[model samples]
Target: MCLISFYLIFVFSMTLFIFGIYFILYDYSLFIEWEVVSMNSLSIVMTLLFDWMSFIFMSFVLMISSLVIYYSKEYMFHDYKINRFIMLVLMFVGSMMLLIISPNLISILLGWDGLGLISYCLVIYFQNVKSYNAGMLTVLSNRIGDVALLLSIAWMLNYGSWNYIFYLEFMKNYSEMMIVGVLILMASLTKSAQIPFSSWLPAAMAAPTPVSALVHSSTLVTAGVYLMIRFNLLLYNSWLSSLLLILSSLTMFMSGLGANYEFDLKKIIALSTLSQLGLMMSILSIGYSKLAFFHLLTHALFKALLFMCAGAIIHNMNNNQDIRLMGSLSLLMPLTSTCFNVANLALCGMPFLAGFYSKDLILESVLFSYVNFFTFLLFFLSTGLTVCYSFRLVFYSMTGEFNFSPLNLLNNESWIMLSSMLSLLYLSIIFGSILNWLIFSSPILILLPIYLKLFTLFVCFLGGLMGYMISNVSIYFYNKSLHYYNLSSFFGLMWFMPYISTYGVINNYLMMGQLSFKLFDQGWSEYFGGQNLYFLMKYNSQLNQVLQNNNLKIYLLSFVFIVVILFMFL
Candidate 1:
């Protein structure tokens, strides 16, 4: 009965998402840069909001929700609490749906706030110590981001207008409003877990794999990309855009490094999610709206598919997810292997894969951007690094020798899981090619020089190759070599964990010692013998004590007398 209800809800919900999302997609051109003009005194000028770009984001929201339901069906089947899980997932999906379609600042805030609310519950779903910590961490980390966004919104409404369209168009004339844009970008950084705001994501891996996958691909991380995508117009000027490029590149590098450091499979995926979002943002920084949105959709397909497989891998293995424990199961889990391999290649951006399309687009975006050769070079190096990590993830997690013997896990997924993976695989491949052909050839497009596109492709392919080669070395040995070298330390050169998470970074014993030192500093003369001096200084000897004691009343009487004297003079 539980199984039947789960299936029913999934089928019905997904049907709605598919129809709703695609209908919006089919009529994307119909969406205009809407403006709420003069009637609302703040809307003095034309605004560029609620366009095809926003519509594209809505489509992604739909795709992720539909795919997640499919993943949850197989994942949630037999548990007695399955009903509750399904309910949360449904509500979560609905919130995201509302988030993307939201028309105004209030609507966007509703969606943005909904992300936190549902995500908080979802993270703590297990009610374990670790899960609770993750949920709390998620909230604490996001608060800073939330503040920045709220302030940004307030500034815009007070100055420009309440309308999102107006905010974008008006920001150019009113340069001060860019502060608001920056604040909103900060919120995006927190939501997407970009660097300096990036600590909560690895902790968030404590959620169920499906939740992690959904968070990474669709709702959580995409908020940043969605913000950047939404403000593609406002993110003008080399200086502001360059700052974004640097931040995005920083996140891309550091997150990939973190992915490399983690042995836990889920962390690898989580960090990869961060890295991919960085690339997406970087692409947006370069003003390739069409390419950015295109990659965003393809990224949703493959990243979610990979996460679904990770969830499946854990489920089938009695929840053991240490990739080091997994080995070559090419034969034992043929179905898992086949589906996972395709997803893995897509993740690594092997040619013709979904990732390949988007990754190449990012390179193109950088190449075509206003930044000179150094920015281009810096972005290229980062792309290569991304390819390295993406492939390393695939090679380390999926393509190794079998460590534990295979259990009699259900090798075949239920209809939901199979359908989602299959559909994603289909979309990941076809989506880019169709876009490549149609968009480039559009009568409107002054297409990019062929040489530039070819160069970007070459760079992407070379990076993929380098990463793949490195991963082929034995996993244990590879880890040992990297550990001895301390590769991650390079990225952390400028970052000190103690400064950001003072209590969190220190060991308990060290923390106690630090606390003692702080207390001592506040207590002046603790070590300087001030306490001993205070005790040594006696205020009264026998004669002096008696004199002072007798004089106390006299002193009060004298003071009163002096007051009377002064008053008489007045």
Candidate 2:
């Protein structure tokens, strides 16, 4: 029954994708709204705005999710709760669709909250302690975005409407509205896993591979980029834009560095996803949201394929994810290896591939733009680091000695999974050219010298050299490399992001909670409200008992004494 349901959903999604393509071809826009609530001076409506942007984005999302769902049928077949997994995945897809179409903040919140809550459910689907921890982090990080959105909605109240689309034009005129823009940018940073929130993304690899392929690669993490694209008009301020650019560039560099030292197969890929997200967000911040959107869509294609390939390799290797334990796999699993290599090359911005179209363009734009020295340095350095880590990944996993025990790693057991990958593989080949043509009617003119125009390529070559030569030398001369243990350990552990974002942020609050329990609940409140009150009542009762025993004589004596004292004072 689950299989049939998934198949039906895939068919429906493909149908929607085809229609979305047709809409794009005709350059058509669609708006369908229904009144959800109405009152004096306040109203709520469900509005879906489907233009080229939403259509293209939704079509790509549906395509990738349908492939992921199909691939998961076999990937998760042994689990007892396969149906539940399918349901959660379906819910996630629906939430992404809701987010994509929503133009109003009210409806967007509904979708955004759904993504956060459903992602938590899916993250913990394995029902282990690690999944529980990872789920908590994922939900909490995304909750920051939710809170920011709520604040933005409250601030938007000053504008007299919940429909942000209507007020985006004049947002700069109002100081409060500009603050709302900053809040929204902060919201995007959290969702996109930029910098401090970066821990949740690599941690979210605790989810099953299919979920990672869909959520981390394309849908959930990219939601922030999509949101910022929607709000691009509000980011005209230089200070806010510069702040965004700095944070996002640092995120990119940070993740790229982390990936170089990472050994876990899923985590390396997750960090790369983080780096790409930083790329998208950084570009979005610099006022070329369309180019950011272009990269967002293309990155989704290759990254999903990358995750799927990693899943295939892990499935064959009995769930072993350490890259050091993997080698010479191209000779064993040719199809998956090919896909992985293709995805890696695309990620490195090899000419004419999906990433080349967008990534190269991004670098070119950065070169032409009048950015500060720090931003410029971070961009190029991170771009080179991207190639460095990708090459490191290929060398460790595909080019070295086969370290696994003898086992028949067949690639033909699950034709469904293979077919899904193949479908995406075809897209990874051609989608970049297709999007490039559809998105930009005219080419962006570059005014750089030839060498400057080729700067990214030169950087890519140098990075590839550094990755191959340095990693190879380290393997051959382990003792020599050990001299840099401090640097290696720091980068390997993601600059201790997992610890800081988890323990560093929570430890203070948890300690304060314990202190409050001890100081107030147990000590002061318990003594005054419970123990002290009991003692006072008991003392009064004893006094009353003594007075009762003495009867009317003692009461009369006490009253006469009190009257005599009052008279003497007068």
Which one is best on TM-score? 2
RMSD for all candidates, in order, please. Answer: 8.4, 4.4
Candidate 2 TM-score over all chains jointly: 0.90
Across 435-502, the per-residue lDDT of candidate 1 in tens digits comes to 55444435333348888767765766787787667666645445445564544554533243323542
TM-score for every candidate vs. truth?
Answer: 0.76, 0.90
Clashing pairs in 1: 327-401, 327-402, 328-400, 328-401, 328-402
Q: Give the best candidate by lDDT.
A: 2
**Worst 10-residue lDDT window, candidate 2:** 404-413
lDDT of 1 at 323: 76
What would you estimate as the lDDT of candidate 2?
0.86
